[model samples]
Every structure is written in C-alpha cells, then in structure tokens.
Target: MPSSAAHLLSNHYNETRNEYYRQLDTASRNGGDILPFINYAVQGFVDQIRNQIKHIRTEQLRIVWINYVHSRFKTLSSRKDRRRRDLLLHISEFGLLHKNIIGVMALKIYAGKTVTTLKRDIGYLRSEELIEETLTGYFPNLKALTAFLPVQRRVVE
Candidate 1:
C-alpha cells in the first residue's frame, strides 16, 4: 500500500477514535448512564473499528486520489491558502470515508469546496499532470484524474 493510502487509513481510524471520545465526553457532561458507555466501549467501538478496517482498501484509494490532486498544489506559498487546501483535503477524505452518495454534499453544507472549484483545481493540475498509466491498477480511475472529483453542489440561494 502507498504511504498516502496508509495516511488516509490512519486518518479514518483517528476520526473514529476521536468520535468515540467525543461521545464519552458528551455523556459525561450530560451525566448520562454509564451502562451505555460501557456497551459502546466493549461492543460498538470494536465493531465500528473492525468494519472500517474491512474497507481500508477502498478508503485508501479514495485518499490516494485526493493526495494525487493535492500534490498539484505543493508549491502554494501562503500559509492561509495551504491551510484552506489542507481543510479541503480533510473534508474530501472524510466524505469518502463515509461511503455515501451525499457525503460531499454534507461537507459543502458544512463548509467544504464546491465541486466546480474542485474540478477547476483538477483542471489546473492536469495542465501539469505527471501521473503515469501504470498507477491505474491501484486507483480506479487514475488514467482520468477528474473522474475522482466529488459531485458538484447546486447552490440553493
């Protein structure tokens, strides 16, 4: 597996772990029952983590694609701009991890990139794209990089 894939899997695992912690924190603050927390620790947490592990490969490919696109912006000079790019990557990775059709939509409503912007970034990258055909086996649509872009969001306003 590529290092990019591993990083994505790690990020997924950490997200799951952080969510679990958040649940515990919320419960503690609310003075909720301890029984459910114990059950979550013993069964829910383990089962969720196991399920995530089962689909690690799919998650890896998703992140690898994002990483490939992100690599295009490696020369960004402004810290603020780089942070925005990093946040975009993080949201994209999270949406991919959810494995849902509306994942990117959810991200957009929560302050993620518009699909057009993402596609534009991809187009920008394509002008100087360096990925070779051999990478396709590892990435579902590696030969056509834009195929990995998230679905475009329609502004309601």
Candidate 2:
C-alpha cells in the first residue's frame, strides 16, 4: 500500500496537471488566459512523473502507466522535450537487457529506426557498455553499465 501522504500527493499532482492541460487547450483554441504559468506547471508535473518512474520497479512500470492518466500518454501527443535524453537511456538499457534474456529473439523487438529498431538500440547499448552481449545471439552481458539504475531484485532478499 502507498503511504497516506504519497497517495494524497499523487492525487493532487494528477488533478493539478489535468487542470493545466484543460486550461492550455482552452487558451490555444479559444484565445486568452493561456498563461505561461500553465506550461510551467505542466512541465513540473511531467518531471515529477519522470523522476518517480525512475524509482519504480520494471514490473510495476505498467501499473504506474495504467494508474496515471495524462496528456503525456495520449496516442497523438508528443513526448516531452526534456525527457528525450532520459528516454533514450532507458530504451537503450532495456534493449540490452532484453538481448541478454531473450537471445537472438531480441532481434524481433527492435528499438528504433526500422522494424529492427529495438535491435539497433540494443546494438548501440552494447557499444555504450550499458550492456554487452557475450555471444552473437543468446547470453547475459558480463556487466551492466547502468550503476545508478535501481536493480529490481536484491540478493539479500
């Protein structure tokens, strides 16, 4: 269960973000009152979501995605500009680990660029040392380069 404070804060942040989106849309379409403050608030909310997601378990990412509703997730909406770098890092890292577990099967998932985009991202990730493929297709990378990324399972447990 989430702490009471966490629950309340999440609720508050979500509501505030939605309000800002509504305001921004109205201002853009109808004109007037489209304050820069609305944009700033939306950016802050997006950052908070990104920061919080960084702390979440991989398995729980889908849960967070499901529970959180924002313009960010809309099919036609673009990703936030500031998040591009972080997202690239995540996509690269995920691609690498995916290769490790799934072997050549990873080729099918491709990260970007083409139908093989996931494969391309993983290839780049290996070059960056975020992960490495011991063999051409199936094998765990000897070391993971993402030292700061939280590992889902701790050995002590």
Candidate 3:
C-alpha cells in the first residue's frame, strides 16, 4: 500500500477503536443494565474492524502487526523496574544477538553501570531464556520475549 493510504487507514482504525472503547465504557458504566446488549455492540465494532482489515494487503498487514508489537514492547519497557526495563528497551531496539552487537558496551553505558553489574542482569536474562550469551556477545530471543510478555490478545470476531 502507498504511504498515504496506510496513514489514512491507521487514522481511521484508531478513530474506530477509540469510539468502540468509549461506547463500551459508557454501556458498562450503567451498573450492569447494558450487559445484554454488550455483545451486539461489540460485534458491530468487530465488523467495522473486519471491513478495514479486509482491504489491506498481506505486506501492509504485516507492517501494521509489527508496529503493534513494537508499541506493546515500548509499553512493557515502561514498568517501574528500572534495570529490567532498561535492558528490555535496549534489546528490543538494538537486537543484541540478531544484530551482531559487540560486548556489553552498548547496554552498559545505557544503564550507567559497570560491566560486572550489567553481566549479572545479562546472566539473569539468559537464565530466563530472554537472551543468550555467545562468543560474540549477548543476543535477545525477541520471539520468545514477545511471547512471554503479558500483552493483551486481539479479539477476533
């Protein structure tokens, strides 16, 4: 898809998603009175979403999906655990193993810590299978990390 069309589609999708959530909140705030009609209303929103998705090509859809994943990772990295979040941010952006990064220098400076301290965190992440240490450097298991994150699943209609 053309850039203009993709932008337009994204705008439209955001608007529709916001409107759907607003309506859902309004309906649910009525003290359970609107329970019976919630599914019907949601189905309408789902249909609208389906219509929007149906026109996009596979490559465009893949781009949108990746953007969604990246956005989710950004949100996940904003957690209160500063060290872990910083590590996650670094890995997601630079891709430790996959990108053929050198030693701990990249994340070491980012965390403002010495190699020893960073190495501990790296070891922990490796134990958790979020990263792997090789002769080259530490690399991230992006697919595994993404799957492990508690991101909300999309509701398909």
TM-score of each predicted structure versus truth = 0.27, 0.22, 0.35
Model 2 CA RMSD to the hidden true structure, in angstroms:
18.5
Candidate 1 lDDT over 1-157, as tens digits, reads 5553445544544667886677678789878867765665555544544566657746766667787657756777575446445534654444322223244445433356565654443344334443221322111235455466565455352
What ranking of all candidate models by lDDT puts the best one first? 3, 1, 2
Q: Where does model 1 exceed 4 Å of error?
A: 1-57, 96-157
Model 2: pairs clashing at backbone N, Cα or C within 3 Å:
110-117, 110-118, 110-119, 111-117, 111-118, 112-117
How many clashes in each candidate? 0, 6, 1
Residue 30 displacement in candidate 3 (angstroms): 72
Q: lDDT winner between 1 and 3, please give it.
A: 3
After superposition, candidate 3 runs with Cα above 4 Å error: 1-80, 97-112, 145-157
TM-score of candidate 1 to 2 decimals: 0.27
The best candidate by lDDT is 3
Can you list the residue pairs that collide in candidate 3?
A: 97-139
Q: Which of the numbered candidates is closest to the native, going by highest TM-score?
A: 3
RMSD of 1: 16.5
| Residue 72, model 3, lDDT | 42
Q: Which of candidates 1 and 2 reaches a greater TM-score?
A: 1
